[model samples]
Target chain A: MTTPTSRTRLSPQARRAQLLELGARLFATRSVEEISIDVLAEEAGVSRGLLYHYFGSKQDFRLAVIRHAVEHLVEQTAPPAEGEPLERLLTSLGVYVDYVLDNLTLYRSLVRAAAGGTDELRALHDEGRFALTDRIFREDAQGEILTDTPQARLVVRGWSAMAEEMVLTWADDPSVMTRDELLSVLALSLPALVDLT
Target chain B: MTTPTSRTRLSPQARRAQLLELGARLFATRSVEEISIDVLAEEAGVSRGLLYHYFGSKQDFRLAVIRHAVEHLVEQTAPPAEGEPLERLLTSLGVYVDYVLDNLTLYRSLVRAAAGGTDELRALHDEGRFALTDRIFREDAQGEILTDTPQARLVVRGWSAMAEEMVLTWADDPSVMTRDELLSVLALSLPALVDLT
Candidate 1:
């Protein structure tokens, strides 16, 4: 029999996507600081120069992985259009919690990387948070109570951080509180924060 | 002419403290993952083996740095004992904000390291949070309105996260809102969280 072929060339777009998928898997448990470009290239079965050619640099590659994961999350957990503002928020929160719990490792690394004080990662993380905040604000604005102003968005940003902490704390130890209770706590806090702002 | 002395020998305790101080300064701008032991030893003018002798591993060294910083923060921002529960909290909040704003670099690295997902650092971060929560809870409990219980402490824990986000957000960009406004937002949210819990 002929020797088996080891590789098939992929289109540029397909190759980048494939590499990002592998990078995401590695980044799930480890921060970019812990993983070297050489290791990433080896893991993807490409030369280090190929990695550089494709992504420009390790930092650029890390950003791509994060952006890809965030886009995937936003798509999967996009809230339904038809519900009361609170109802939509609760539904979205439930889906978010499920997603977070399902990918605890990746979520942990995302938080770790975001907090690592890198300007690029911090900006990416903030963009993701603001996107969710905007969604919630849009729903809340529809209720005709809180107008979608700069101040309103700022409040939503703070609320988003609280919600994040709620999910993270619960995911860290679900035994401490029921999921329903956790969701309720976050939901109840939102209106008060909105009113305060 | 007598040979000029370049350095002096120090006691073990003083030497360890000196090394930790140097390590903390470096760590303020970089995560432990990014700072190698060799660099640290070289910066301290000590041998790598001496560093190993002082700290079991890089992880151990990181914990010591974090511990020292936390202790220093607690001492400097210790809330006054004589005031209403809410009054004490507000005063402590001001002091806490000053401390954070003053040591922005170290605080950033501390938050970064804590979220870096290491068990030891996470434990240290949690302990620091709990200590602050306990202080707030003691004052709140004095009012006999919210007794210190596991459930009550849980609420404080969640509140602590929000307060942390508030402080971090403020530190990241002071132009977004006045310091008083941020503190007010946090202070107002406290009653609602306590009520819900």
Candidate 2:
């Protein structure tokens, strides 16, 4: 929804990405209550009307930021290939740790939004975690480590929750464990959480 | 720090509890930025200065509300005795689920505060979860079920994180699973994660 002005013309995709990046920075520093479309527009070098045209409202913009952040994490933690399922799982965990470290502020804001009970944010959070869980379960099934009684789904859900919280904790205290070591241990231990016997 | 007149009227503990209760309700309904000290004082039926006297600042008041909420949850989830470690663990999970269902808005606000990254709020969140994890580990050790290793700590940490996120997800989707059923399955599968052989 970019208005192709003679002075300032950019592709729609580029403009949207710009807005999301700026908005994510603002959200990281302040509460959602402190952010407004007017401020975002001013910061993004666009008109207030243009901001609305692009994002609809502040809530919509916040939702967009959450989506962008989640997508970024998902891309970083893409499933590994050509290894033991446990080794691949450890690689994914390493990706996750790196992602959190690189985007600490954005990740914290995303967690706040997810835990805040807004329907939009909740759906976005669930979608990202559920996709990861599905991947994990598929890998576990391939390894003959899953049961047929829906227990695998529960364990995956539990692992997703665990990873999310663990990353947050790691952000607070990076010295607790090195990223590689934590990921390796998690990789080694996950098989036990499944029916590896 | 109540004035002489206010001191004559109410006991210190009752007044503190009352303020925290009202603060929780106010924080749940409105954005934290929108709730001023004066507004909170008026809502809680106290003078602005008196509220400050009791809490020192808005941040302190928010921390008090968080601590109060956690303490209440702990009271609800008193550990079960005379049972196997897994059985007791399941009982604790059931208590946690029921508490969350009964106090959804409050729980959401607490989670939001935890994820907000304020130092005080983060400490409060960690203290509560760690207390529960320590108790669980103690019970498992006494029952000769838990391994003594850094791995045990990771399992405890992972379980703590999983429990927090699961409560958040279940709060959004009440029909996902019955509280008792989820806890029972968790109890059965938890050993795999903890090396509680």
Candidate 3:
């Protein structure tokens, strides 16, 4: 019997992971709404039934892709534990800037999603935000720059919003400022924001 | 003959303004989606026909109310022309914080609207944002705290986002920080954000 699409010899788990990676890759450049099951299955060389078997539904597939991207952003931008506090923050921020640039379209979608995405998508976005905060609190646990206080937490949360806006604006138009200039504004502004508080 | 709703002996323009004012007042406490024409007519003591006559459909009424709120916010937050640069920024921020506090529900609605409001409502929000930048640029025209460059415009734009997030967070939970404490954090942040760049 001739198969209509390529069927890899991977395990079910590996196949699922591979499909999600493909979904994420597609989602990065375009919007989730535009990603069709037929297209995804065609791109992944899988049957439509297999895509459904893995993801349950189209919405489920989109959420998984978004979740994957959020996890990647959190994992990629984490600061090394042993570095100087300032260096760690800036280093993570640099990775973050690069991450957003690589996922520029997703960033735009995220802004829209944060404003009006589904409750599921919004909850995912919230998890991503808290992941950043938790990452910072880990450094704060070392008693380096930030102290673990409610006020500090608020500042960090607000600063995340600030950084997101700055990065988004810069990414939308890099001609407005050099990447380094944007990075400096972000890295320094956190300390500057916390100073008054 | 007695009118079922309260109809004042006012001119057409005056009555229209009065209806819009009542709409704005109700919208502040609740949401646009929840504000029915029947309830509004009852609240303002105007006939349903008159409400429609003044503001067309329900959607038109909703947009007008949102636009009214945006205009009031922009008009109320503009800084005085003759003041120290830092003082002007702080005073405007102070008023802004109070404005958000007084209109907390609308502010919450605005955040949602910004994320997923109709194009018309989003454009109104954009107008309010630009109005702040224009207010600052008016001062920048005198060669004050900012030089009128594209970079400066971007900075101001991002700073407004930063300030909005900060205010929203604090307003959501005033127990996190006292009012003045929040104000200080906001006022110090812009200069600090600009210092590095």
Per-model lDDT = 0.75, 0.71, 0.77
lDDT of 3 by residue, A1-197 (tens): 22332555878887777777788767666655678777798777778998998899988888887788788889999998877887888889999999888878776676665555667887888789899877877786776677778888788888888788778878878998898888777777776777778
Report the poorest 10 consecutive residues by lDDT, candidate 2 chain A.
Answer: A1-10
lDDT of 1 by residue, B1-197 (tens): 11111166779888888777777778777766766667787777667898899988877887887888887777776778786766666778888898889878878778777866477888889888878878766667554436665555666677787777778776877877788877777776777776765
Cα misplacement distance, residue B139 of candidate 3 (Å)? 2.6
The CA lDDT at A147 in model 1 is: 69
Top-down lDDT ranking:
3, 1, 2
Candidate number of the best TM-score: 3
Scored against the true structure, residue A63 in model 1 reaches a CA lDDT of 88
How close is chain B to the truth by TM-score, in each candidate?
0.85, 0.86, 0.88
lDDT of 2: 0.71
Poorly placed runs, candidate 1 (over 4 Å) = A1-19, A29-58, A142-145, A149-151, B1-60, B142-145, B149-151
lDDT tens per residue, model 3, B1-197: 23432745888887877777788777767655678778788887778998899889988988887777788788898887777887887888889999998878767776666556666877777788889877777775765667677777777777787778778878878998998888777776766666667
Ranking by DockQ: 3, 1, 2
Better of 1 and 2 by TM-score: 1
Candidate 3 residue runs with Cα over 4 Å from true position: A1-6, A22-62, A140-142, B1-62, B118-121, B140-144
> Which TM-score does chain B of candidate 2 obtain?
0.86
